[model samples]
Target: MNLTRTHAHAFDAFDHLATMVAVLRRDGRCVYVNAAFESVLGLPRRALQRGRVFDWFVDPATLKVTFDAVVANEFATARLEALLRRPPGAASTEPLPVHAIVTQIDHGEQVLLELVEIEQQTRQDRETRTLDQARITKELIRNLAHEIKNPLGGIRGAAQLLEMDLESKALREYTQVIIHEADRLQALVDRLLAPHRRPHMVSDVNIHEVLERVRALILAEFPKGLVVQRDYDTSLPEFRGDGEQLIQAVLNIVHNAAQALATRRQDDGDARIVLRTRAARQVTIERQRYRLALELHIEDNGPGVPPEIRDRIFFPLVSGRDGGSGLGLTLAQDFIQQHHGLIECESEPGCTLFKIQIPLP
Candidate 1:
């Protein structure tokens, strides 16, 4: 392919995009491929230029037709879904689904193709909704806790006075139950308000060290059967965060994972949890784009989160297990959000993975 200095300079800008982009003639021969395109296809730019864009898609027939229609002046732009084959042995063997958009470039025969990952769009939408819901939930919880708090103290104090005056043993027993239940509810309310009330202590925090503390705690608690594996990206740079809070946040996730493996533990099966850390580039968090980010995956080889409550897992008082406080994940989410990060969860019958993403400095 040959291009004028002006055309080459203009096309170079596409490399900055996170979306996969390509330029091709009306005949479907590739003229240029952007950096994202090269990365996803796992092919070099020189190699990509050797093949027509039509050949890269699973349904080449549809792409070819779309190309013909746009070039024929039927429409200047078109959007369609197609699957792109990835390199062998990728993490997921399934073909990547993308929303392919094609637009005619001015009056020329060249058409520019931009591919947005379908799954990524869905994830971003979910993240946005989750964050909105969490903000509402945080405010409601804090307000409710305060309302319930004052009455709770009064009730407990009254119960204590009544118990002191009661001569009958039975009456005293009833007062004891009231006092005990009040204390329990008080503890629960305290937990509900903890994240919002606690001051965020900021400093340099190494992600590996945080994971190690959680790992040690999980191992100590479940000393028998569970295996906590570490797969750290040692080169990841430390970021300014509250190390103690991070420790608790990651600990909550690890602890939940360990508890979920109870059946495996009872049977002395191979119960395992993997803590994986990696550096992510060109990432978006809460609508803010960053050049680099840190990604942590807390994966377990246990029965996945129950589908019934999976969507509400981070909401306060939502839990799959009976007698569970259901505040662990809620607190975890709060801590991560303070750092301008997000946590996403995926689960199936035999596997569950929690992915935590925080921007890097």
Candidate 2:
């Protein structure tokens, strides 16, 4: 690779961009590559510069045609939707779908190519839907909870009055049932509206600390059978958020994992949950891009979330287990969203993974 050192300094500005950029000669000799491109290709800058840009695509012929037209001045720029080949050691074997933009550099012999991930739109769409659903769910729950609460207080007061008026023991016991049931319903309504009512306490929060607290709580509950593993990146910095809310959010997911592990424990299977954290770069949360974010994953080796309730796990009153209130995950989602974060889940037969992503300053 015969490259001038001056190119690196000139391309330094491109390094900050999230889009993948590459400067190349008309015949495909690489002049410079940006940081994002290096990450996407899973290769070092020197290695990437030595190879032709066309070689990175799964089908180089189409890129070759597009490249030639742009360089020959037939078109000042050309856009091609193509598949990019990933590194041999990449987790996914399939080629990455990307929209490639090729442009002629002004007053220069070099061509500029920018590649954007096509699947990024799909991810953004899912996030948009999740956010919209959460907003609607919150509004519906608040309205429903208040409606129930008003009638509940009236019924409980009437039951108490009737109990005092009754002289017979058996008749008083009947009134007692009504009062007890009304109180239970009132408690349920309070829990339903707890997130909206509570004040968000803001402070610098360490993600690992939150995970450690959740780990301790999970272990205490299943000390003998469960093992909590940690794979943490110490480089993650603290961010402003509600520490208690984060703790409760993580604990809810971890506790759910422990509950799912009960079947494995009965069979003497290894019940394990892994708490992993890393500093994610160039992430978009709630449609806002951040230079850095905390990616925390709580994964369990147990029976996966039931298929029926997997999609609606964050909805109020939806539970995967028998007698489960299903409010744990709902509250957790609400708490995280209030911090401008999101929680996502993926489950199969033996693996259930819950990912929590929050932006960091």
Candidate 3:
């Protein structure tokens, strides 16, 4: 328990920490940095050790005040917001927004610096908001579907009666149109409420089977230009879930990707969609942590989701492609959520990944 004792194991544990941590001397030189810090900043520990900590901050003026406060013993700890310049070869080139704290770690002789990516926090907030929004959307859709049901039945019946009474074949075409339109609306309404009404039929589900079923369907639809490849962890354990619902949810996502690839590369035969699956340990979905979970990824090599509708794509009736019902993802999200899972999307030109994570029993 002596503070001065050399704890090799404790020091080594810092390298594997999830939080970004750096130890700095009072003169601003970084003495050591954890693996997470290096990974987030894309700067190696040696690189950080060679330079002053302030060199990494985009706004040195603000960081300087906090750095001085902790160094001067005026404050035991100081926190500030700053933009971090992304290192070369990073996924993004833009400066990253982060919450940084400088605190005395060794009686004012050394400072412990912690940097947290704002995006990480923001994403958690968004997930919470998304769950609430999904609940509200389902309620609204159910009410609207019920309201449309009675009138829709009446409209269809009236059209049928009008068609039967008409003598002229050409005039009867108008009544047929009315009936057809009513039927379409009714189908749409049913789709909107389908997830809410369908009972979850839980059973042991082999994820590979579901992926294979969807793959076959995709290949049958776009047999020539597109290829569906499988990347699965065969060791994954079977879990309890609604097999049919899971199939439908995965099918909707893979089908959407196939459709996008086909549309974007009508003449290119190299269009590809990968159905990948893996097991995740200690995963968090919808604010609840699970010891184990199954991760399924639907990735496509096509023009990514349209930027305009990307944020709203999961909302009912919001589609990136023309004539798309946009109910595919909405239903997919709902079905997965029912199983205590989450679906997330990340898209950029030529690469789009839809990740579905569900707890494993």
Candidate 4:
């Protein structure tokens, strides 16, 4: 193939795709960068066309491994999953998870690379920490439940004994409230330990089955005008996972969406919940990139997640709903992360999208 014609066709193809693509000389000088690259990196095409690829990477150490992989031709294509820091003097230098793939081209004289931003790494890290904290919390709940539950039983007995001697109706009512509140707290503690105490049943499970069950449960509860739609890719492979945990995780999310739709249903509004699944390629989770991943999304057309609570939605006890326990999302996140997956949410006034990506076994 003629080098110039080959380059032309490659450039044409790269320009047509949505992902960021760039080509560099073996010496690391940028030779071609598609429009997507310019748009994503916020750099001009002309500025990057002739510049060295190293100039764009904020960290020198990262550039070294990436360039070395191309020069050595160790692998036809090498992928480097790194955090790309913004350039100095920029408004913000927040680290972004980037999937950088280097491919040797033109008989090792040039390197073609592509980059995609995987935003779930930070969320996964946060979730892993949260899961560890949850384990500690479960231990605390177990200890507290045992300590308090026994004393409460004795206290309730003592209160009943006192109530039998007291003639004042007000005093009896106060004792009843105490017993009720204690029982409520006990129930709450039980929920806290529920996930940890549950038996782990590992099996080869299809993700769509879990989503379908969740969908059915949600639709059954809100059958009037709320529509639960599914957009699933049936070709995805089964993964070795705890099906019950997965079902609980997906159900928590969908149930929350259903509850969010309550107000809309009252006003005869359009309440829509969408369950979508797809096969994601080269997805990175918990700082590890897999060749393939199963992507699941639970989106709702409600008032959307409140902006004030959006950032902390996955944290325990943070909720946007009234009278919500606020542990549903936190538990859901913990379960998914245990399966080496992560969940993310994006919300506005009219739409809220929660995305879950898990690796295939």
lDDT tens digits by residue: candidate 1, 272-331:
999999998778889898878999999999989999999999999998887889999999
- Which tens-of-lDDT digit does each residue in 75-180 have in candidate 3? 9988888898887788999898888988997678888888878987787788888888888988888898999999999999998988889999999999989999
Give the runs in model 4 whose Cα sits over 4 Å from its true position: 1-157, 164-168
**Candidate achieving the largest TM-score:** 1
TM-score result, candidate 2: 0.89
**Residue-by-residue lDDT tens digits, candidate 4, 1-361:** 6764666566876765545788888878777888767656677777777678776776757766867876797778878776665654556678667878888888998888887777544555665665566556646656875787677677777877887898889898987887777778767767766766787788999988888888888778878878888898999999999998999999999899889888887677688888999987656666676767899988988889998988778776788988999889878987887798888888998799999999985
Question: What TM-score goes with each of the models?
Answer: 0.91, 0.89, 0.74, 0.66
- Candidate 2 lDDT, tens digit per residue, 1-361? 5346788877788987778999999889898999999888788998998888878888999999989988888998899899999889887889999989999995548899998888876777888898889889989999999999999999999999998899999999999899999998898999999998999899988888888888888888788777899999998888999999999999999998999999776677589999999888888888888888889999998889889887788999999888998899999999998888899998998899999988888
Once model 2 is optimally superposed onto the true structure by TM-score, how far is the C-alpha of residue 20 displaced, in angstroms? Answer: 2.3
**TM-score between candidate 3 and the true structure:** 0.74
Off by over 4 Å in 1: 1-9, 86-94, 106-109
RMSD value for candidate 1: 2.5
lDDT of 2 at 314: 93
Candidate 4 lDDT score relative to the true structure? 0.79
Superposed model 3: Cα runs more than 4 Å off: 1-77, 82-97, 101-115, 263-266
Better of 1 and 2 by lDDT: 1
